[model samples]
Target: MPDQVTPPPSMHWIVPFAASLSEPCQHALPRLADAKALPNLRRLLGQLQEVARIEGDEYALSMPHERVLAASMGWPDVDGQLPWAAWWAAQDGVKLTADAHWGLLSPGHWLMGRDHLTLLDPATLALSETESRALFEAVRDLFESDGWALIWGASQRWYASHPSLQGLPTASLDRVIGRNPDVWLTDHPQARTLRRLQSEVQMLLYQHPINDTREQAGLATVNSFWLSGCGPVPACTATPAHIQLVNALRAPMLADDMPAWLDAWAQVDNTVLKQALQAVDAGKAIALTLCGERHAVTLATAPAPGLGGRMWQSVKRLTSSRSGPDPVALLNSL
Candidate 1:
C-alpha cells in the first residue's frame, strides 16, 4: 500500500469579523427591557464565534485576527498600528484617537478591505438616522445577493427594508439598532444565510452517501486515522475531541465505515460524540478518505501539521484517565 495520500474535498477559507460589540450582547441578561430582541442577536453572534473559533483551532491556523484585518485592509487598529500618531502630528485638527471613536470599531472584519465590496459602513455615523438606515438596507441586500451571511447580527429583532429577504422568516421592521434608530433591520439576511449554510455544510458531512463511484473509478484515497491533543479539549471548540477520536481508532477504515465508526463512538459517550460530530461536520472538516478498512479524515484538504510529543502525552493521559474506556490501551492491545 502507498504511504502517501492525495487530497479530498477541501475546506473553504473562513473570513472572520470581530463583533467586539457582540460580546456585550452575548453576555447581557436576556430578560432586559428588550428581551425579545436579545435572544436572536445572542444566538447569531454565538454561532459566528463558534464557527470562527472551531475553524481556527482545528486547522492549527488562526483565523483573520483583528490586527490582520485592520492592517491588511488599510483600516485603523486600536493598538496604534495605523500610524495614527503620525497622522495626528501632521494634521492640526485631527482629534480622532482610538478611544473616542463611536460608530466605527478598530480592527473590523477582513472583508472590509479585501472584499472589494462594501456591506455597511461602520463609519457612516454622519448620516441622518433615516439615511443611514436606508444605506444599511442596501448593504444587507448586497450581501444576500452575493450569498454571504452576516452571522453577527442575525438574532437582533429587526424588520426588512431591503427586498432580499422578502420570503424569509423575519422580525418586525420596528426593531432598530440603538445607535442608528433610522436604520431598521430586515430579516437579518446575513445571519439567516449563515445558519442555513452551516446546516448544509453539516449535512454534506453527516449525510453524504459514500461515493462508491469515485472509489470504484480508482480515484479515491485514504489513510490511517491519528489524533493529537495539546491540552485537555477546550470547551470552546472541537479539535480536542475529534483528534482524540481519530487517535483512538484501533484500525484503518474504509470511507463507507464512517457510520459504523460513529456508532462505535456512541458506545463510548453518546452526547459528546453527537455534538462533536455535528460541530466537526459543520465547521472544520469537509470529508473523510477511505483506506482499506478505516477512514482517515482531513480537517480541510490540507495535510495536518505533523504531530508533536504533546500528542503522545495526551495519549498517556487518555490511557490513565477514568472518564471513559482507555482507547489508547485498547488500540495498543489490538
Candidate 2:
C-alpha cells in the first residue's frame, strides 16, 4: 500500500506553489533530520523548545509545524500562515509532508484517539479541545459572512487559474480551490514568466527616478507611475510639467484618480520644461515652510550646498573639466 493517501479524502492541503525543493534544501535535509526518535510528548516538546531557543522568533508555537520544520532545518524564519493540507497533517499528528507519520503536541498533552500533530496557532496551542472548537466555529462564521473562500492549490499557477482568464471557461469553486497541479502546470509556462516579469517591472518602478520627485512635490504617497507611451492616467490631468515635477521629486502618482486641481493644470513644453524642472529639483530641498508675518506657506526651496548638492557640484565640475566626454551631455543623451 502507498504510505500516504491523496488529499481531500486525507484532509491534507498542499501549498499554492509546489515547486520542488532546491538542491541546497534537499542536501540540507538529513541535517534537518526528522524528530522520529521523540517517543512521547515530553521529548517532542523539548525538541521544539530547543528549536525556538536557537532560532528565536523563527519557530513559534502558533505557526504550522511545516514552517517550523523549515526553520528547524535552518531555512530563514517564515510567516506562521500555511495552506490547508499542511495544516491538516499537523492537526492529525502526521508529518507535515505526506511522507512522514510522526506528530508533535505539548509535553504530556497527547490524547489516545487523536494522534495527529496539532500544531497550534498562537491562541490555541495550550487550549482545550472545546476552546479550539469554539474558536474555529467563530472564525468559520466570520469567513462565511465575509464570503471568504478557503483556497487550496498545489502551486501558485493553479491558484491564479482559479480566477477568470481571457476567454477560457471559468473554473468551478472546487476546481478553483482544488490542488490541480497536473492540469495547469502543464500549460502555464507563461504564468511563471509573467510572475518573473511582474517582479522585475516592480523593481524598476520602485527604483525609478520619479519616486524622489513625488516626495519633494509635497505629495504623501507615490502610488503609481504613468509613463508617457503607456496610457493616460484617469482623472489625473497632470500636465507634462506636473509629471516631470513629480518624477524629479521621486514621487509616484497612482495612474488612477486625479483631484480637481490637477485636472485643471496646463500643458508644458517638453524640452524646456524638462530642463527647468531638473535644474529646480536636482538635490534641492522643496519642502521648506516660509513665513511672512501672519501668513505661512509651503515653499519649494532650492538645493543648498548640503551633502547631495555637494555631490552634484562635484560631479558637475568633473564633467565640465573632462575633454573626452561631457557627462551632462552623456546623461541627457538618454
Best prediction by lDDT: 1
Summed over model 1, clashes come to: 16
Question: Model 2 Cα displacement at 332 (Å)?
Answer: 53
**Which 10 residues in a row give candidate 2 its minimum summed lDDT?**
224-233
CA lDDT, candidate 1, residue 79 = 25
Expressed as tens digits, the lDDT of each residue in 202-319 for candidate 1 is 3332322322332355532110000001011111221112222222222111112333433433343344333333443343433321111111112232223246644664565467
RMSD of 1: 24.0
Per-residue C-alpha lDDT of model 2 across residues 1-334, encoded as one tens digit per residue: 3342111110111111111122432242232123331112112111111101121221122222233233323333322212323333333443332222111111111111343321111221233354334323333333334332222221110111111121222111111111221232213332343234223433433443443443465532221111000011112211222221111100111111122112211111133223333433353222211111111122232223557756885676466422222112211111
Q: How many steric overlaps does candidate 2 have?
A: 22
lDDT scores of the candidates, listed in order: 0.25, 0.24
**Which residues of candidate 2, in runs, are more than 4 Å off?**
1-87, 90-125, 149-334
Cα RMSD for candidates in order: 24.0, 29.7
